[model samples]
Target: MDRQAEFVLRTIEERDIRFVRLWFTDVLGTLKSVAVAPAELEGAFAEGIGFDGSAIEGFTRVYESDMLAKPDPSTFAILPWRSEGPGVARLFCDIQMPDGSPSYADPRFVLKRTLTKAADLGFTFYTHPEVEFYLFKGQPEAGEIPTPVDTYGYFDNTPHGMARDFRRQAITMLEQMGISVEFSHHEGGPGQQEIDLRYADA
Candidate 1:
């Protein structure tokens, strides 16, 4: 174990954390999570908790269903939405085979493999995702396209703009999780919005 892992263990106790969720993405980039009681965290960090990989679309075949999720200490963050109560935290995990090998189907491992290749070639790469999204009034019914919150155009500013407030809140939450926000603005399309993340080393 490293200092960062030790620190996480200590912080969990000190904060009286009720649950710690281990998160990982599947091959198609869908996030998944499994919560562990704080008491089990140390063991989880050492020997990952098992899961049925076959059920997690794109993970493993039913014949070899067992999978392990080993939490990455550095990616730990307290979910801002869950911070006010019993305090739920989360950590990104690297999936592994039962034999302790990296699972090729894990999205994080795939990125690590690519980054390793880049490093070997004496090159460093950064990834920045500028996300453009629309703000709908509420959840849409099946097959129904929901209405936009407003008819704002690019860089439109109004005294009362729902998208503006949304951007502020989203950036605040992301910053609390130690993620950086480079920029945010309304897009050209009605209720469409965009937020750019700071480049992260690959």
Candidate 2:
């Protein structure tokens, strides 16, 4: 086993981690996860865990549904939200076929392939994404638009801005996961908010 994999095993045992969630995304970029017991991790690192890909959107058809999720040790991190009981950790996985080949339908594999091609061409790909979202007062009725939490505009700063507190909490959690945020602020629309992520190699 590699040094990273060994390190992961040691950490799991020391932390008393009970569940390890293997994470991946479908072609549509929807996050998917499957949890495994800590005892099965060594085998998972060796051969990967199998699942039926046909159930996921944009994956293989029912006939060729068998897929493997090989966890990437480098992306392992303890989930901060689950602070009670035995700890829960997560690892981003690389999807593979039954024959141990990279699946073309895997979004992470496609991105990695693109990054490799870019490196071969003497270019480094980087991205700084500005994510925007709206805050609704509550869940709306069927077909009815929800009301905005506030009438805040661009860069608006209020002493009692709920959006401000939300952003602060979000950034804190993201940092705990080793993700860096460039900045965040209110957008021009009512209850709209924006967060700019730090530029990183894609």
Candidate 3:
């Protein structure tokens, strides 16, 4: 087995991991997930887990729906916010055909193919996403706009607000997932947050 895969197996066994979530993105960049039990992880690492590709956005047609999700052991991380018990972890996956060929419809494969071209040209590419999301006070009714969780303006250091707590929790979780967060702050819009991310090639 590959070292990363072996490491994952060891970690799961030693940590008493119960669930392992396989994560991947569809062609339109929508994230998809499937959870596997720890007992099935070794087989999954060897042969991949089967799923219906036709159901995923832009993945495959109904006629050619058979697919495999091969976990990328290198992307393994424990989900920090999961309830304390048998640990829950996640690994990003690369979609593949039943015959073990890389799936063209997989977003991760598309990005890797583009990166290979950049590599051939003596260029390395990196991405730092400035992600933004919102917090609302309550669920919206039909055709009704949801209220902001807080009225705090940009970087106001609001005292004891839901937005502030949300940001703090999100940052902490991101860090635990091995993502380097540069900083987080309130955006100009109410209840919106901006998080600057940084990833440098070592």
Candidate 4:
């Protein structure tokens, strides 16, 4: 086994990780996941865990449903939210065909292919996402906008701002998983917030 794969195995045993979640995305860009016991990880890294691609939107037809999810050890991280009981870790997977070829339908494969092309042209792609969202009091009724949780504006720092506390918790969890947050603050609209993630290679 390679060094990274060996490291993952060692960590799982050392941390008493009971479940390892394999993450991937379907063609429509929706995240998908499957969990496996620790004992099955070695085999998963060697060969892959199989699943029915046909069940996933835009993946494949029922007649050719077999697909493999090969976990990428480099992306392994213990899920901070799943800290109770035996710990749960996660790894992003690369999708493959039954014969071990990279599946064209895999969104990760598409991104990697594009990145390779960009590299060949002496360019690199990076992304710094400024995620914005709204917080409402409750579900909105038909043709009615839900009430804002707070009437705060851009960078408003108040003692009772729920968004401030939410951002702190979010950034903490993100950092625990090795993701960096550049910064975050309230936005212009009421109950609107923005969080900027540090730029990273796409």
Candidate 5:
């Protein structure tokens, strides 16, 4: 076996891993997971796991429900947030037809194909996303904006407010997971926030 692949197999075996989580995303970028016991890893690698593609959004039709998920070993990483006590890590999979052809509709595959085109043209595609989201109480009604969870503005401190502390904790966790944060600030919109991640090679 290759050095890196051998190293990963050895690490998993030595760590007493009980489960291997296969991770992937739907067309809309929603994260998905399928966990298998360690005993199944070898089989999974040799023969991709079968799943019903029709069940996933924008995957396939009912008549052609058969599909496979082939794990990409390189994306293996311990999910730091999952409280599994450290022996477990995840591998992202690429979707394929039951016959083992790449699923063109897979969003990750779409991105990969686009990047390949860029390579053929002597350029590379890069993406740096600025994530913006809000933490609201329950679900707000139409045309009705929810009130800010806290009155803290920018770096202002409101003793009773948990939002400021939450942001700090979130940034810390992101850093722990190796994500570089360029900056974070309270957006002009009430209860809205923005986090700018540093641009880097993927």
Candidate 6:
């Protein structure tokens, strides 16, 4: 095991971790989870836990329904996004068949496979998402026109402005969780703003 993996296993034991949550995404990149108690973790590390593959979207057909979720220890991290406890930690899993081969339909696996190919060619994939959204006065009704919440231009700081305050709060939370923010600015459309996240290699 590498130093990081060793540290995670040691921390989990020393910290009295009660649950280890395995996470993965579907073909459409929707997150899914399964929680296993600390007692079963070692077995999970060896032989993966099984579930009904047909139930999950795009996993398997009804005739052959068994699938497995094998956790990759390296992805273990405390879920700062959640406030649950016995304190939850998450690991990304590789979906597998009952006989132990990787399931091609897993979206996480697809990303890993693509990254692996990139690695073989001496390249890496880096994504920097610029998320843009708008805030309106209230939910728009059927055929009801939407109006801008504020009239502030790019980088204009007005005291107690709703749009400015909301974006600041969101960026603060993102930074607290170790996400780096490059910039935040008002977009061309009214009440619309954009937050650009800094890029990093996985």
Highest TM-score: which candidate?
1
Which candidate, 4 or 5, has the higher lDDT?
4
Q: Write the per-residue lDDT of candidate 2 for residues 1-202, one digit (tens) a residue.
A: 8999999999999999999999998887789999999999999999999999999898899999999999999999998778888899999999999999999999988999999999999999999989899988878999998998899899988568678888888888888889899999999999999989999987
lDDT of candidate 1 over 1-202, digit per residue (tens): 8899999999988888899999998787888999999899888899998999999989999999999999989988888877576989999999999999999999888888998899999989898999899998989899998999999789887457678889899999999998899999889999899999998975
Candidate 5 Cα misplacement greater than 4 A, ranges: 1-3, 84-87, 136-147, 153-161
- Clash pairs detected, candidate 5: none
Better of 2 and 4 by TM-score: 2
Candidate 2 global TM-score: 0.93
Q: Estimate TM-scores for all models.
A: 0.94, 0.93, 0.93, 0.92, 0.80, 0.73
Model 5, span 1-202: residue lDDT tens: 3455566567678867767899888888899899988777766776779999899999999999998998777766665565656467778898999878899878879988888888999987666768776766666799997867754455443454445566677787678656788877776555667778888754
Instruction: Write one digit per residue (lDDT tens) for candidate 6, span 14-54.
Output: 86677789988778778888999877766777788899989
Q: Where does candidate 4 stray beyond 4 Å?
A: 138-146
Off by over 4 Å in 3: 140-144
Model 6 segments more than 4 A misplaced: 1-6, 81-85, 133-178, 185-193
Question: Candidate 4, which ten residues in sequence have the lowest lDDT sum?
Answer: 158-167
Across residues 112-192, which tens digit of lDDT does each residue of candidate 3 receive? 899899899998988878999888988899999899887777787876878878888989999988889999998888898
Angstrom error of the Cα, residue 153, model 4: value is 1.6
Q: How accurate is candidate 4 locally (lDDT)?
A: 0.92
Worst 10 residues of 6 by lDDT: 79-88
For candidate 6, the per-residue lDDT at 103 reads: 94
Error of 5 at 46 (Å): 2.3
Better of 1 and 4 by TM-score: 1
